[model samples]
Target: MVEQTIIGIDVSRDWLDGFCLPEKQRFRFQNSPDGYARLLEILQGMPDDLKVGFEATGGQEWALWRILISMGINTVQLPPAQIKAFALSMGKRARTDQIDAELIARFMAFRPEAGRALPDEKLQRLRALTVRRAQMVDARKRLSAQISACRKQGVSAELEDMDSILKAFIETQISELEQRIEGVIAQATELSAKAELLRSILGIGPVSVAILLAEMPELGRMTATEAAAMPGLAPMAHDSGAMHGKRVISGGRRSLRHVLFQAGLAAACHNPVLKAVARRMKERGKPHKLVIVAIARRLITIANAVIKTGLPWRISSAA
Candidate 1:
């Protein structure tokens, strides 16, 4: 039998800090095409059991990840925070690329599921388009705010020429991005069906569907509680002995949590089934904001169930 080998690489824009566990070997490579080629050259005949893991360094690790995965390598892009916590747990405080790389290896050796597989290329494109759209939308809003400020200060004309064209350009870009997102999803049969199913629910529109498809590809595969916790909608307990402390929501992906808030709020008001869930929570003296979160949880839970079962949402009294 072949021994299992796990390698961890701490990714930076300029260099890759690597450590191969069990073998206890350390190496460094440039963060470039040449570097990637050199790294692959070193591992040309590795066994099928070989696994490589790295922390998600924003967009920096994307190219290498795609390359390795394309070559049928087992790779995971881990959450940096978890790696940091793992280092602290081991009482390793001095931070360096080499140390981080070792910690990532140890972390993966300790918990194989600590990292996630990257989504498919079409999902990646959807995320890229949506992220750019969000940036453009935010820029347009800022420009509009500046125009309003100028009007208040009696100098509105100063931005008249620039703001109009910039805002128009931003809107046009946003529309084009939306079209691209739709096109990408339409080209993927699984995503197209999922999007149709998601949009069939009340209070979930194209933007919400796009977000779920892009960010939560594991939507139907996980449990309801897991799905809710993915977006930080799950209430975390704060109990010690008999203290029985208050429950609060925290952690998880912030963008997913944010997009759900609006959908949750809208569902709490507009979706009759979800609105009833909110009403019950409210009648029990739950704060309106708390009720909204609960309704959002319900909304996503139903979404998960429906997606997993390949069915559509229906009014249900059970919360």
Candidate 2:
């Protein structure tokens, strides 16, 4: 592969700033198709191929990414936190839009693989919807807390009425979102089929399936342990040299972790395999809740296996 020009894109709501090296070409555009066309026109003259990189800013960056990807231009989407950390380590006196763009460009130039670009329009849409739903769910929780406190303290009638209204509204909105999520899944043949496969496994359901489709489309793409680690459920050693300690899990996708914990709860109640695991753990004197978490992790392992091998779950009563 010929070495190409490295370009960093600083993206915002209505405009984007691009910086390139060697010739030091910099330009600002309207962040529209017309603007993207202009930017591409400038990039077409590079000596080698073109490598474009940018940081993730939720859905704000999605349009530009889609546009670039469709144009057959190689694009790299860096995690925002990773880029921010890179900036901190650079030891720059002060930061500007240009500085951040330069950092992204530098990272892309050195560690080209740090920029991972997934070419999935449907998956991208699902991810956006699922992430937004998570945010809404969190907001609903906060609002519910406020309403609960108002009722507990026997606040004014008007306050109670407002709280009730808000709670109802949030619930309605959540229901609508849930229905739309199912619709989105049903519309995508591959995703819908995969989701159905996921649901066939014990402890996995519509919501969990939706999340798995969005956050981890790579379940079957790797080993069970690898997938579990991505969701932050893989067990890790917590020992200190000579000091013996338990294995604990750390640093994974919080949403996936949450879904697994909830699914584990349901699985422990009904999934024969997980129930057996929970029983064995309890026999070993494990804490009740901790055993449930263990069951969740095991369920995750099984789920990964099912997705990978395209096999239905078989609960062996002999076990």
Candidate 3:
């Protein structure tokens, strides 16, 4: 039997620090095209079951990750939160690039299933658009708040004019991004079908569907419970011995969870099936937040079922 080889990398804007386990090799290289070539040469010589792991350092690691994947290297993009928790567990206090690389490698070795493989190129592009659109939307929201504050303070006309112009530009950019997202989905038959199915669900708008498709690509393939859990809608239990503590949810894709919460609020008010679910929970004296969480879980389950069956949501089927 062949043992698996794990290589963890700490990526920064200007350098790539790496540590290989079992062999305990440490290396550093410039984060550039030539550096990628050199790194590929070394990786190509490693064992067949080589697993390269790295933290998702904003977008700094993307170029190297893409290159490694293109060269047929098995790469995994890990969440920084998980790595930090692992560091805490190990009582590691000091921090350095080399130390981080070793920690990532060891974490991969400890939990081989941690992190995610790269999504396809089209999904990647869609995700990028959605993320950028979200950023711009947030900026517009903050600016609107500031504009309101300025109006209350009786700010200058010139400042108000500038705010209006900037706000218009941000809205235009958001619209363009939405168009690009739509184009990306429409260009692929599978994505189009999935989008259609997702849209058939009550209260799931275009943005929600795009986010689900982009962020949670495993929608159709996962179980209903798995689908709920992916967005952090599934309740987690805190129990010991004969005592059961309150069930709460934590950890999953945070962005998807936020979108689902918004979708849940909409569904609770407008979606017939989910509205009934929310009513029942509310009547049972469940808190407003808990009711929303329940609706969100139900929404995801319905979505998973709709996608899995390749059928549009019908009252009978969804109920």
What's model 2's overall lDDT? 0.79
> On TM-score, who's better, 1 or 2?
1
For candidate 3, the per-residue lDDT at 308 reads: 88
User: Which candidate, 2 or 3, has the higher lDDT?
Assistant: 3
lDDT of 2 at 2: 20
Predicted candidate 1 versus true structure: per-residue lDDT over 150-230, tens digit per residue: 778877565677778888988899999999999999999999999988887887778888888888888899999999998
> Would you list the rank order by TM-score, best first?
3, 1, 2
Candidate 3 residue 293 C-alpha distance from true site, Å = 1.2
| Per-candidate local distance difference test | 0.85, 0.79, 0.90
Question: Which tens-of-lDDT digit does each residue in 1-319 have in candidate 2?
Answer: 2255888888887888888864467778987889878987876766447888888776777887887787788887876656776777887657667777777787777677776676487887788778878888888999988888878898999988887898788788888888888888999998887887788877887888899888777778888678778777888887788998988877666788999888989888888877878888888999987887677777777777877778767776221
Candidate 3: C-alpha lDDT: 0.90
lDDT tens digits by residue: candidate 3, 1-319: 2169889999998899999988999999999998888888889999999999999776688888898888888999998878988999999989999999999999998899988889888998998899998999999999999999999999999999999999999999999999999999999888999999999888888999999999888898999889988877788999999999999987778888999999999999998888888999899999999999888888888888888889899766655
- Name the best candidate (by TM-score): 3
Give every collision pair in model 1.
none
Count clashing pairs, candidate 3. 0
Q: How well does candidate 3 score on lDDT at residue 198?
A: 93
- The 10-residue segment of model 3 with minimum total lDDT is 310-319
